[model samples]
Target chain A: MLSKKQARAFFLGGTVVTFLIFIGLTIFSLSKGQDQTNHEGITEQVVRGKVLWEENNCMGCHTILGEGAYYAPELTKVLDRRGEGYVKAVLMSPVPWNPNGRQMVAYGFTKEEADDLIAFFDWIGGIDLNGFDTVVSPLAKDKIERQTKN
Target chain B: MKYKSQKVAYWFFAFSMLLLVLQITYGFIMGFARIGFDGLHEFIPFNTARAVHTNLLVVWLLSGFMGAAYYIIPEEAQRELVSVKWAYVQLISLAVVGVAAVIGYHFNWWEGRKFLEIPRQLDYLVVVNVLLFLGLILATLFKGKRKTTTALVLTMGLLFAALLYLPGMLPFDSQVTDSFFRWWVVHLWVEGVWELIMGGILSFLLIKLTGVDREVIEKWLYVIVGLTFLSGILGTGHHYYYIGVNNIWLIVGGIFSALEPLAFLAMALFAVNMYRKGEKKHPNKIALFWTLGSAIVSFVGAGLLGFAHTLPQTNLYTHGTLVTAMHGHLAFWGAYAMIVLAIISYALPNMTGRKLYDSSVGRAAFWMANVGMIGMTVAFGVAGVAQVYLERKFKMDFMEVQAEISIHFVVLILCATLFTVGIIMYIMDFIKHGKPTDEELDLESDL
Candidate 1:
């Protein structure tokens, strides 16, 4: 039963509200510091694992350093969170516990390959972006670098 | 031999229903996998099943729509289809190509894009769509009747759909450019062109069912089509925001995509208003269910949920998450699936001269489907929000977060199970109990 003017007014009001929400979120995101890491050089095993990662197209599901599909979790920080041993263990666990009793068939990796993957993950965990936000559009690469220097 | 148009429509409608059953089964299995990951590798892995579920949905809905267009276009033009044989050819080719594509997907041969994963073997599917589009255009033109606004809008929508792949086919070296064009296919098809098509078809069905003045329905159709293209084309900008695009895309995409919902809301209002004005007393309650249900659900699913994450700020958290899946499941169902169902309901009795076997049973199935869809949407939507919090805001250990949200997975499984049951009931009722009476056959002559 709204008149044309009333509908227009209602739409304008809604737009303003959405705009404000967007601005608030943008500001909040800018405030959060970028995550960084500090670690040592990669080994031969780690290098081999990196190649496997590409060949298998793991990035199709799992993101690393916020640069892949969101279907799976980020693996860049995996080593820091779970340590090398736990990483290998989870990789080798053919039947990980499913709380809802629905079966997830495990892709069982070889023991040596699992260790190499852990090493590669550990290498990725050590990259230091110096707390400049990395989740924004890749076009903001320069701005991120500037922020890091400041 | 007689009523060839109706016969073709019903046959394809039946095919669509069969595909719907398979898609729902896959949907349930995928839902269960979300809850428990123990038996994913059996025959249909999660990714494989998900691809099949989504692709089959697209195929079945499009087939039904093709059938509906063939049947309704001629009737609205007050002439027989210009070439019924051509229509049959189009259907046969589309079905053959569609089935081949689906089989390829089941065997894990895909193009790797989520919804665009039809294998190279079915690359000719687009050619088939183009042929059908041309057939429809020719039929409307040769009828010698002036094109109604509804027919014009539907034709334009089909034209856009045929041309949608242009950007995707551009020889772009950069992945980002390719991705941007991909959204042109995805976003424009669903948001822009599909909305117009749905508007046109909805108006046609409402007019036929309610015996309303064609002018009134056509006017509503015009407004909806205008809003659809105006809001939809620009709204593709929203998806461009995250994919290595400039910041201006954020503003353009966010603003326009946010406005896209208003057009859908307006369409819903128009339909309700028409129903109120019409003289027919619940002529076909099943058609009304689909018509009204589609309008309402599309507004909420495609429009609201689309706006929820249209902003670049929100997109950062919700992109590629289950939130996106929730939007997709409901939007496709509301916008495409329900419209096709409406067409089926409207045409079935006409084609068969059968009174719906049991009106109450059909109505009951409608409620069950609606309720089940709402339940699924709510469950998945909340789960998506929880996922955003766990992954983006809190940045918790990923596996721990997954373990905590296993309950949401269980809820999703339950909702999907309920939806599957409703689908089964509807299909059973349609097949076993749907027979028309002699009086209904006599009513067609009144047209």
Candidate 2:
């Protein structure tokens, strides 16, 4: 039988402990990695891609920058995982996948739009701050112009 | 047995049970979709099933609680229900509107969020809730008793619930305002108004079941209600943190929501203390199970996990993740569902002239439900962490992210299955083995 004063003390003590833990964890996370920048003016493309993603409700299935629907893959580091050409090819192939039995239908895009999408992916795939491997695929400098220009 | 108030209560319980069955079945289908999307996509898409599951859960819990209030208030006030016929009218109207809204949702008519998607199918659901609110107000007013603090808090809760719904229907230009108003309805109702209702009901149960002085229980009720408004209203800030809102919401939401659990923890302590100090041996030990279970689970579910994500920093990671779902499932069930069960256990015997149910089976069911809920919460927490790691940390392929975290998903499915089994067993125990005796009937009038 804890008295009222004791109960109050217990709650206050527990809250302080919890608060400290949250702060400590956050600081720990922040201190873990160094920042890296591969693209200078790619913010616009990433922003455009984000708008397009929401318009199409892509986040309803896919996640990007750690947000959105969980049904699809994370797109933040896709550029690191798949190069610019593969990204463009996947976007423009009109046949997303041809697995053993299941097939992913293509949302057909023009060549220019596909390249822009790849540029957007490339932008996201380049964020590597905090030692977190947010990069999805590594981008080659030659392909960067082609992807961005498209 | 012959009392009209008791009959009305039973009918309300029955209706609530109907909705509960539908909600759980939808939940199962939603789980199956997660596991085998290709197999079940056409029959019941994930979005549709999720909408139905969450909506039905809210409706059923509210219905059961409304029914419990009708039964508890009349007895506490020591008067016949002011308008028995009006009560029946309110019940039937709310039930009809709720069912119509749910049916509308099934047919692809929804506003698109989980608990807020009551569709234009029967916009009258809002009207019905207001009517129910009026019914409660009128009943309390005409009963010729001073408004107890508990009743006052409950009435305030209902009023807020009704008022909150209006903004949801407003035409807003900015999605931010829309989202804010939506949380005002959804988050405030559950974490704020609903807590008030729980405090009132739990106090009422404590007085009746423990033979504790109303003064003691009512004092506890006042404290709980105070914490509720103080912490809960401001606690809405937690939801605002990530939704493109101003940064000030970060501090306000984090601090207040963090403190919100204190009220729940206090309520748990109150219950335990009352049970310790209780002089009379409660006739139905199972009633105590419902009572204690409601307190402990609500504290753990709503208070603890709620604190975890209340901070802006944590919310950034946990928002929209499985962690949110885990918090919701346990908190809502603990606050509303278990409270309703507690009230039902206390009143059902009196209403039906039944003796107490088999205590052992009731106790077993309680443990089963509690264990399964804890399991589900753990599974979802683990899954949520994995999700953040894959999406935020590793930036893994989307499908591969899900596949990697499939183990947590499987654990959650099993936990839900276990929870459903426990609920079914409890329901069966109520119907088949509940106590039926005149002595139990006299116990209510003795108070």
lDDT of 2 by residue, B1-447 (tens): 323454567777777878887898887775655555445554455555666677788778877777776776665555567777777788888887787766765555566543566764465666665676567655654574566655655665666677767766764433334455777678778887778778878887787667787776776666676676667776777776654344556776788898999989988999988988889776877778888889988999899878877777766666656667778778877878899888877777677665655466677777787788788888878887787677555645445656667788678888988887788877776675344333433423544
TM-scores of the models, in the given order? Answer: 0.78, 0.77
Model 2 residue B342 CA deviation in Å: 1.0
lDDT of 2: 0.66
Q: What is the lDDT of residue B403 in candidate 1?
A: 69
Q: How does residue B40 of candidate 2 score in lDDT?
A: 52
Q: By TM-score, how accurate is candidate 1?
A: 0.78
CA shift at A25, candidate 1, in angstroms?
A: 25
- Best-matching candidate per DockQ: 1
> How high is each candidate's interface RMSD, in Å?
10.0, 8.8
Clashing pairs counted in every model? 11, 23
Chain A accuracy as TM-score for every candidate:
0.53, 0.53
